[model samples]
Target: MVLASGSPRRKELLNNIGLMFRVQTSEIDEHIDAHASPQDNVMKLALQKATAVANSCDDAIVIGADTVVVLEGQILGKPSDTKEAVEMLQSLQGRVHEVFTGIALVEVRAGNIYRTQERARCTRVWMKPLDRDRMEWYVGTGDPMDKAGAYGIQGIGSILVDQIEGCFFNVMGLSVSLIDEMFKNWGIQVGTKIRSQGV
Candidate 1:
């Protein structure tokens, strides 16, 4: 299997699950089309990433996932730098936001493609109010520079979050239960939950 994502946390999550797979980071553009709903946007990007890699493989199942931080129906992508990261965290501090993760699976054979399953999930996250001192230190570690929403539940940024409603892994990057559901649709079994702590 090929995992089409650049996130180290997602890679670790899959590895911890004991699933063997290859990693191929997708370069697909992620600008959301205004006509598409939030869910549709994520699904499209995830499919695009998976299909791109699957098309090149000899024969493999490709898994692609896209995550976004949505606030008041607007999608917030990864920050470009420390300043933008700080601004994003500032807006997200002490508030409830939605984290959406889209999953897409595809199979490539003889240059032909079949999209197996594609879907999106949303999780409500409540962040504890952060003061400037804490934000500065967290950003200094540079974890927020690459993650969408400028905070990673699997990193030092965990201190900023209060709780989450829905899949906790979704907030980290991928949703294990959702991924299991996708596998079930494809007649594959992921088995059981993978208990992980400390992000």
Candidate 2:
């Protein structure tokens, strides 16, 4: 299997599940069309990422996922710098944002005869109000610099969050429960490697 994302967090999540997959970053452009709905954009982005690599890897099952944070229909992307990171956190303070992760799995073979999946997982993330000192300290840690919504629930950024209303793993990156269902729906019996992990 191949993972077509550059995120270390996604790699860590897969590793934690004991899945054997190779890292191959996809070069698909991720520009969101202004007219596209959030669900369409996320799913298209993820499918593009996976199929882009499927062009090169003819013998592997490819997995690609894209995460986006949306509040009141406004999409918040990765931070440009610490100041932007702080700004994003401050904007999200005391508010609820919806996190969407679109996952795509493609089977590769002759002519890449395969299937494509685009499933969106959402989590309601409520952040505690950000204080000046606390926000500054969090920005200093540099964890928010590359994350969507300017926070990571699995790391130091967790301190900023009050709670999540849905899949906790979706906030981390990939939704394990959703992924397992997807795999099964695709008729892939995940073998012994994932049995211990409750897959």
Candidate 3:
């Protein structure tokens, strides 16, 4: 099994579940389609990443994932600088936003894709009514620059969130239950696989 992403958060999530998998970062273009819906955009990107990595594997299950934050129908991606990070946090403070995480599973045989499955999950998050001082303080920690909406729900950014209305793991970048369901569709039990590997 393989994960087609360089995100440490995704790697930690998979490891926490005791799944045996290797990391293989994909080098495909990640340009987002402005005309596409958030769900469609994320799913397409996830599939592309999985397919790119699966092409090099003779027989392996490749998992790819992408995450984005949407607010009032606008998609928010990672910030390029601390200034943008502060702006992102400023926009998200005291408001409810949706976090979308798309996951793709590609089964490869003989270096060819045999099957593909994709899923997108959304979680609603409400951020605290924070002042600029707090937002800048959080951004100064250097935690928001690389996260969607310039916030990391599983890290120090948790203090900025007031509440969540869906899967907490989805906000973190991957949904364990969704991935487990996809694995079951292929007659694979995550727990069984973990036990077999004695992990």
Candidate 4:
């Protein structure tokens, strides 16, 4: 199996689940479609990454995933710099935002896709009211620079989050439950590796 993302969080999540796979970052652009819903955007990006990697493999299952934070219909991705990171954090300080993660699996054989499966998982996160000093100090730590929505729930950003309603892993950029279901759909199960015939 192969994971087509360079995110350390995603790598850690997969490792925690004991899934043996390799890391292969995809070279596709991460542009979001302004007219599409958040879920649709993620799903499309995930498949784009997965298919890009699958096209180079002869017989392997490649997994591609993309995550984003949505606030009142606006998509917030990784902050480009300190100022943008601070601004994003401030905007999300005391509101509810939706985090969407899309996962795609592609089974390739002889450079052709045999089967494909994809799913999107959403988690609603509510952040506590944050003071300017707190947001600035957190931003100085440089933790939010590479994270979506300018926060990382599994890290120092956890203190800013009041609560979450959905898969915690989804906010971290992957969904174990959703992936398990997708694997089952491909005749693969957690803790066991069994590829169905013709898959």
Better TM-score candidate (1, 4): 4
In model 4, what is the error at residue 179, expressed in angstroms? 0.2
Cα-lDDT of candidate 1: 0.84
- TM-score between model 3 and native: 0.95
Clashing pairs in 3: none
Q: For model 3, how does the per-residue alpha-carbon lDDT over 1-199 read when each residue is reduced to its tens digit?
A: 8999999999999999988888999999887899999999899999999999999898888999999999999999999899999998889999999999999999987788999999999999999999999999999999988788999998788899999999999999999999999989888899796457431
Candidate 3 accuracy as lDDT: 0.91
Candidate 2 worst ten-residue window by lDDT: 190-199
lDDT (Cα, tens digit) per residue for candidate 1, span 1-199: 7899878888988887777777998887777887777788888899999988887887677899888999888789899889889899999999999999999988776667855689999999999999988888899998898888999987577889999999999888888888888887876766332222110
Residue 51 displacement in candidate 4 (angstroms): 1.1
lDDT of 4 by residue, 24-93 (tens): 9999999999999999999999999999999989888899999999999999999999999999989998
Prediction RMSDs, each to the true structure: 4.8, 3.0, 1.8, 2.1
Which has the higher lDDT value, candidate number 2 or candidate number 3? 3
- Writing each residue's lDDT as its tens digit, candidate 2 over 1-199 gives 8889989988988887777788899887788777877777778888899898888876777888888888888888788888888888888999999999888888787656377777988999999988978988988988888888788998788888998899988887788778777888876666553344332
Each model's lDDT comes to 0.84, 0.83, 0.91, 0.91
What C-alpha lDDT, on a 0 to 100 scale, does residue 43 get in candidate 1?
Answer: 87
* Candidate rank order under lDDT: 3, 4, 1, 2
Error of 4 at 61 (Å): 0.6
Error of 4 at 69 (Å): 0.4
lDDT accuracy of residue 44 in candidate 4: 93
